[model samples]
Target chain A: MRRFVRQAAEILRGDPAADRVVPPTGITARLTLFTAAAMAFLAVFALALSLAAGRLADRWSEELARGATLRVSAPAGEMEQQLAAALRVLETTPGVTEVQPLTDDEQRALLEPWFGPDLPLESLPVPRLITFQETGGGYDPDGLRLRLQAEVPGAVLDDHRRWRRPLLAAASGLRVMGWSALALIFGALGAMVSLAANASLAANAQVISVLRLVGATDDYIAAAFVRRFTLRAVAGAALGTAVGLAAVALMPDTGDTGGVLTGLGFRGLHWLWPLLVPLLAGAVAFLATRIATTSVLGDLP
Target chain B: MDLVITFDNVAYSYGGGELLTGVSLDIAPGSFHFLTGPSGAGKTTFLRLCYAALQPTAGEVRLFDRPAQELGRDGIAAIRQRIGVVHQDCRFLDHLSVADNVALPLTVAGRDGPAARRDLDDLLGWVGLSKRADARPPELSGGERQRAALARAVIVSPDAILADEPTGNVDWEMSQRLLQLLVEFNRMGRAVIVATHDLGLVRVAKKQVPARVLRIANRQVTAAGADL
Candidate 1:
């Protein structure tokens, strides 16, 4: 283990002579840099998506947890009576801070997205929605339900989990998808780097044979390839990260909810997370080239 | 440690055929020897075994008195640093200059400092390649490349030098100069083994240095009958 660490350190420290052994121009050279930059760009966007989704989930969870709605549906003659009774019951309930029954026009606006703006609150037998705020100690739903069932029999208590859970769940899923995208971006980087390293090693077979003849160990040869590809990846990833950050910075922050227009770009210390892309890129290149070099050199005399 | 290379009944097979069988030889320190063989003979294979480039199919081949098999890949690499090899093709990194090519051994051994630079300059001058220092390997002439290969082999001041047709592409005069360099190295207490097809060069070398000629005609190597 110590030897391995020492070798890795030595490789990173670099030997210009060893580095020169590999010809600086080749398909692998350009391919590695371009691949790293492209992958890093995608990775930065994925990072932004994840942070935005996380913010959305947190805001929605907080807003949803603090309040719920009580809907009252009854015959036209008894609708007002049930609504009054439910409001009275809610006013007396412990931990219930404020209760306000939504007006007819407000109900139409709430249903406008689905039922259209001309929703006829005068004709349809729509249930009345009463949104209520709770204190830090929330009211007991079971106690409220039992009292409402006995008095205002048409009243239905909704804790709001039906829509809240799915909203929060969708947000959580978006965050996961963002993270999975980041993982795939890095994975593709590793695979591409490994392919480039393999091609470079094969192209430089004669160079390798000469180095081995002149007393170069497999570690020395491997270090040369690793140093080249790793540095290229670092430089490319830095470029990509810069451009990505700049692009994110220029995005319009429009909505209070989260998406590209609002919370997508990093805020405060969160900006530091994307900076890890280059270091991770270099690490991926190092490991991939090391494996490729070892495998190729093993087949030589 | 008495011998630089020792082969004990070593045999090697390749391509479904045994190229070398029951071959035993000893290369003592500071000795000068020539290996003469036909084209199909195992001369190159023997030189490779001497440098631990190939493991013998049977028996043992020891380098610096340590069994080649006992030395792992890294260990063999370290051992190879003490022994320099010059191939018939003068295998070089064509992208590097003549000076850098000559200094390749030191570079591979991780000694590319000022001291190594000084050695490279001196060696290039000795090989009459100082003027071509900046020229790449492909830019050099046949004689110049051979001289560069020679300089590269001795750059690290290895304990032993193995040459496979070191003068193959050069003229008689250039061959003589290369032979003289090998002889000088042998006089400096570094063992020299030259594998070549030119009996005339071997005959010329015998007159100047006390050397033995080993010929490989069949699947074995035997000491040639008289002083060449």
Candidate 2:
């Protein structure tokens, strides 16, 4: 840690002679800056996507796990009797809170997305869906199912385990993929910085030779390149991060009903997370340049 | 006198071909020596060995009582700080001004300051480059560049100075002036070794100072006769 602090201080202490050693190549400088900015921009989006997916997964798991649905299918004459019997059984079950039967308009609204607004719910033989919210420890689905089967005869209890598990798994998978994309962006950024450093070093072979001839140590020479590249990365990444945050902020808000698209942004304190992009870029550039410079200098004399 | 450099049966080769073989020499403080040889007699290679720039292929080369191979990277750099070298090409950071080029040794060693600045001014005046302090290296003549290289070499007040073909590209008058600078440094108790093929410069150097003249030919080094 002490050595790292000293190295950081040395980097901050500018070396004008060392800077003069390598003449600036305009192409490499521009290339490095542009690459860093591009990578940081992509990285910001990936971070947002991962966070949003995580929130979606958590919300889906909690809401779906805390409730159960009962569907009763009977002839028009017997439909009322079956729903009344199911509601009566739920009222006496442990941990069952409020059981409410869906009105015809509510059922039609749920099906409107698929069947359009002209659906005739009164003529269709669709089963009635009764949703019951749970409190404390939710009532056991197996016991509830046994009681409903014996009493209501035509009623089916669904704790949503079969479909909810898969949905949650899919959301979790999406979150993992978003994070993996971020990792790949970082890897590409490091590679680009390394290539730029190597090119600069190769172009300044004579400068390095002159420095080494004048008793400049390898660390001194390497420090000059490392400092220059690190600063460039930091500057480029800062600009990219700012632009990314602005883009995210401009996205349309969907209020409480927002789906995946509207939810793709930082929430509250999560806005501070993109601030780390510049720091990460600087660290990557520092390490990449150091490694390349050291390797090249070792081969010099 | 304390010896500053030693070579014990040192041999160097490139691409499996020998350039220098069975060479032994010593450089001591306050000594003045001239290395004379043909164009391809490995004169530059020998100087490089003296400064730890190149390791000997067979025997050992020592600088200030330490084996060249044993010194770490930083140690080698430290050793080099005490030994100044003027190359045949007179390499300089072309972007830097004459003053900066001449004061490069001090800057590299982290000794740059107001006092060092004054010393740089004096050194430039001694090299007759006082008026050209702001001029870049590319704007200087061959003689001027050679003088700047010499100025840089002595800026650190090194214990020994090595010049490889210092007069090769300059006129006779400029060559004599450069020789006088080396002789002045030698009189200050610093070891000076100059490698040149010009026998005339060697004779002139001998007249200006007590000097030893050595010649290399056929991969061997020997003391030259005074007949030259």
TM-score of chain B of each: 0.97, 0.98
lDDT tens digits by residue: candidate 2, A1-301 = 6655565677777676667666777998899899888888888999999988888888888889888889999998899998899889999899998788999999999999999998898889889999988887767888888998899989988888897899899889989999999889888888899999999999888888787777888888888888888888888888888888889989987755776668899898889999999999888888888888889989887
Which ten-residue region of model 1 chain B has the weakest summed lDDT?
B101-110
Residue pairs that clash (backbone atoms under 3 angstroms), model 2: none
TM-score of each candidate?
A: 0.91, 0.92
Q: Candidate 2 DockQ category?
A: medium
**Candidate 1 lDDT by residue in tens digits, B1-228:** 468999999999998999999999999989998999988798999999999999999999999889999998898888878898999899889898889888887887878899889878888889998889999899888888888888898888888999999989999999999999999889999999999999999999999889989998788989998756
lDDT of 2 by residue, B19-128 (tens): 99999988889999999988989899999999999999999998988999998888888877889999999999887888988887788788999999999999999999
> Which structure among the candidates has the greatest DockQ?
1
Clashing residue pairs in candidate 1 (N, C-alpha, C atoms within 3 angstroms): none
Candidate 1 per-residue lDDT, tens place, A191-274, comes to 999999888887888998898898888888888888899999998899899999999889887668545336678878889999
